[model samples]
Target: MKPAKDWHAAPLPADEAKRLRQLRSLALLDTPQEEVFDRVTRVAAELLQAPIALVSLVDEHRQWFKSRVGLDVCETARDVSFCAHAVHSESLLLVEDAHADARFAGNPLVTGAPHIRFYAGVPLRSSGGLVLGTLCAIDTRPRKLTPAKQAALCDLAATVEREIVQREAARETLEVQEVERRKLRVSESRFHTIFQRTPTGKAIVGLDGRFVEVNPKLCEITGYSADELMHMTFQEITVGADLPADLELVAELLDGRRTTYSFEKRYRRRDGGTVWIDLSVALIHDDEGKPMHFVSTMQDISGRKHSEEVLRGYRQELERRVLERTRELTSSRTALQTITDNLPVLIAHVDADLRYRFNNQVYRDVFGVEPSSLHGTTVRETIGAAAFEHCLPYFARVLAGERVAHEGIVYEGAPNRMWNATYVPEFQRGEVAGFYIMSQDITETKQRENQMRSEVMLDALTGLPNRRALAEQLALSIDAARDAEVPFALFFMDLDGFKNVNDQHGHDAGDALLRQVAARLKKTTRADDLVCRLAGDEFVLLARGITSTSACSRIAQDICRAIARPFEVGQSEARLGTSVGIAMCAGGTQTSAEAILAEADRAMYEAKRKGRNGFRFASLLAEVAPAINNLVDRGSATRH
Candidate 1:
């Protein structure tokens, strides 16, 4: 608490430059007072029983107060500033009485209003180790701070230093967030422009024909705000005369009978006005082919309907014009080129003759040809004969007025990826015309699913096959023995002294020991053998084509010896043993995995009962029991 010996407050001009730079970098000068800094000053004043306390920063030409308890002035000239001397000092500046000190004996601050007599200031350093300013206590009457009070004042200064540095870091974070907001604004602007392009109403509808998202354009067409529309379904606002046909098409889209279908419909708006709109609807699906939502665009078509009514009075003159419009309808289908071309999925239409009629941009990206250039090409010619023949049957089904959604087809054109596709039959005048083909690449989804399945079969602690994997292999082995009359052996093993090792050293060390044992077991077994951990300290090995008594017995001995070796556990070595029991099967009529496993388990305990590290054979097949007995009689019992 007392100032260190030989330490004096001497203002160095060279150090002042770096100190002032660090002070300004905090951006705390000439600002309103903050409560974090004010709280510390208040505590310093109360604990010391002083009249004035401040968190003062030394600027280039002035000493500014960031937080002041009783001081009236916010700043003072640097030459007359008492805190300026503490800004470059490694230790605090403690002046018992400014009037008695030779440095400030005749200073103006000692003779003027609000005169200073006692000053104790501690340097607040930046994280870069440059002193910025001081947390000071002042009184008009001469006094001295006790050792405990000096220590308390230093602790308060440390609090102010922490707040200074953290505020600077927070400012940097705000700058980063501002930049991210600017980028987000630009993205939103682009979306707004596209959303308002040509559609009078745009929305994302749920499977139940309820609005999930409605753009402002839709809100304008209907007299309801976006929030009010959310609670109401599209069917509720539709004119009842047009409701049945609209519901029918929606059903067809949901049932996979069509990828997309558009029709003119009338809506009963909020004011009870009938507004006709050309509504284009398409269903969106997840990676598993489940419907997620529907994206719909509605364009005002009240004028078109009025024109149709007038044209019906001049039927002969309108015949040629009607044929031209029919051609456009057959080509553009709802004029959805803007939407379909932007979609990530591959979409195309084919005629009854299997000739490609239309395709979106994704088709060109996949096939390496312009979609327009491929318009007149047959499906077989564009996809090549091999892929064409594979899809021919599905095309026949679609052309027969059936909808098909397939996920198992391995398209030769993209052999490295999986695909999900929907074929929707396009009908004209009660006959099948062609179909719309929509496909999406689903390689990543399938890969993730396969990874999850593999993790389930693996032991997370040891990276060995787990009990589930062992059960699968055991089933296969039993079926092979029963049907093909082949023979196999199952080894039931439990590590000796493993529990004692865990109890003495801890579970973490036991896990380390188990991983080492698993590595050794894998090395000892043959490549065709299956090694897996059942649960804590219990393991199973399925060794195929090892039915001979001597072969199976030697295999068990090798496994026992492998596990008997000392394992390096943490900083120490742990010694453990194994008790192994072998169940040999050679195509007996009563051979079963459960019966063999139980017999092997009993034999394993028998080996443990005889001594810890040893192997015993329980030949479950009646044909092999006699040979196994002879081997036992030949003094072939192994014990380590």
Candidate 2:
């Protein structure tokens, strides 16, 4: 055996600092063995026909096994780990005869216990492109991995990566949800404090407009005790002129036509004198869709109203001053128009009748209409049917004196655009006269969010739906099957002898084979059937609306046959078969996606146990949880 030359003193990767951070983020260092990870290592060892397999995570000073199929020790020093070197490699690091390799010939791992002879490793890369560790197979006897076996090893490694990424995503989602929940709690606390302690009159009224409960400030404002206020309706205290209009709004609320209404009105105090108040009321509903109560807040505005009346007595002098003020207002209007026209957002005003009163230049630029010509035109006529319909409900709420904010897609011009719009009620003499509209183009932002979502749900290598997407599709299929009262089948397939192709020809050839296989699987399935690459050589097909178990068996057979055909990659032709297991959901039955997939997985292993290149079907009624008693022969399944 050649003496090892500074193998323990190998230089760190260039991105070592960033890589360590990425590894730590997974929170998996020194973690106990998990079945999900252990299964991958077990499969790797069985398929590579190696005695030992490990899901190794390389830490700063040691290599820890998240899963160990044959090794006794839970971890080893980084200096002697074959995985340390393998993590730095982009492709599989294979040492057919470790004693012949200078790097490991005299290493402690090779010279001491276990006496490692053969090794093949594929780096476990995080979604962010950092190499965290490796999924490796080792043997006590010297042996080379066929190209197909190498590919199978790589596939197993990819599965480990998928598990890591999915866990990370789920953790992040939980963190975000926790933050939102905390914020909600804080907001509720603040709202409660304000509602109880604010100086404004606050009360809860029944559907009859009579106070059901009143705060201290409300009693002070009405010159009555809380007990007295509870007996008197708002209509009884309101002056005659404002009473009828307020009652009409209450009627709208009762009919569920409006959520809120605000207005200024006079209330006759206990002393028989009138006081003006600005009042806002919102309807609350019970869980069973019944009107529960209304929340009302009122601010005394008697001083301001009195001052306005005093100024009205000087009408002649006020009229003379108004002439000068009108000129100043014109200049201010011009300045405001200049600002609005230069802004990137669309700004406009529409009356209660939905007629456009005014709009900025940006409106014309986006909608391709003359801003001046929009005056007195109905919104439906100006923006066409699609955009108008999108805004109609919000428009109704705003015209009813409620503020509305929403996001929607506007399909106009060459391509559709996303927008965020806000509508605020405009008041004339304390009544809703119109609404001011502001909309910002959010197309770029929306597209970026969609792209991120797509990337998260797709497999970067094979361009197939990843496990996350498969789970979602399976859930949808389950729902559809239950709704339509029909049966559906899930097929779990593992490629036979894919590792040999990776071992002989190279990982590039292995990748090409996977992509080709994915394409073939997609082509073989019906358009409505979902085909997903779960991880590595494993793929899942969801056959929705299947009629019977016989149909599922035939589909599974067809897939196995299709995959048995030789794959042409460049100058080489590699052949691989499939072991398929199918699970069917009966009509009108309730079953979760996880339950169905688990059944299919069990059946697939049954096929592998029986022999490669065949199909097996298992129903929900079958006993699917039994452990495998023997390992399948890896050499029997091969790529040319």
lDDT of 1 by residue, 416-439 (tens): 777777777877899998888777
Name model 1 segments beyond 4 Å from true.
Answer: 1-329, 333-338, 352-355, 376-393, 483-487, 545-547, 585-592, 610-612, 629-640
- Angstrom error of the Cα, residue 283, model 1: value is 44
Error at 167, model 2, angstroms: 35
TM-scores for all candidates: the values are 0.45, 0.47
Query: Would you list the C-alpha lDDT of every candidate in the order shown?
Result: 0.77, 0.79
Question: Lowest summed lDDT over 10 consecutive residues: which window, candidate 2?
Answer: 625-634
lDDT (tens digit, per residue) of candidate 2 on 1-640: 7554433534577667888988887789877889999889888888878889999988888899999998999999898889989976756788988778888887888887889999999988765557889999999989978887787787778789889888878878887788788996754565478666898999888887788777777777778887798899988889999998899988987885555677899988888888899998877766566779999999898997887687445432433333234334545767656656876767777888999887888877787888889999988886778878887888889988897777864846414778877777877899999987777778887797789989989998899889978877776677676777777888899998787777778888889899999999988999888888998889999887886655775687678788989998679788898988778887777766656888888778757644457767665745532221111123223321
Candidate topping lDDT = 2
Task: Give the per-residue Cα lDDT of candidate 2 at 412.
Answer: 63
Candidate 1 has its poorest 10 consecutive residues by lDDT at 1-10
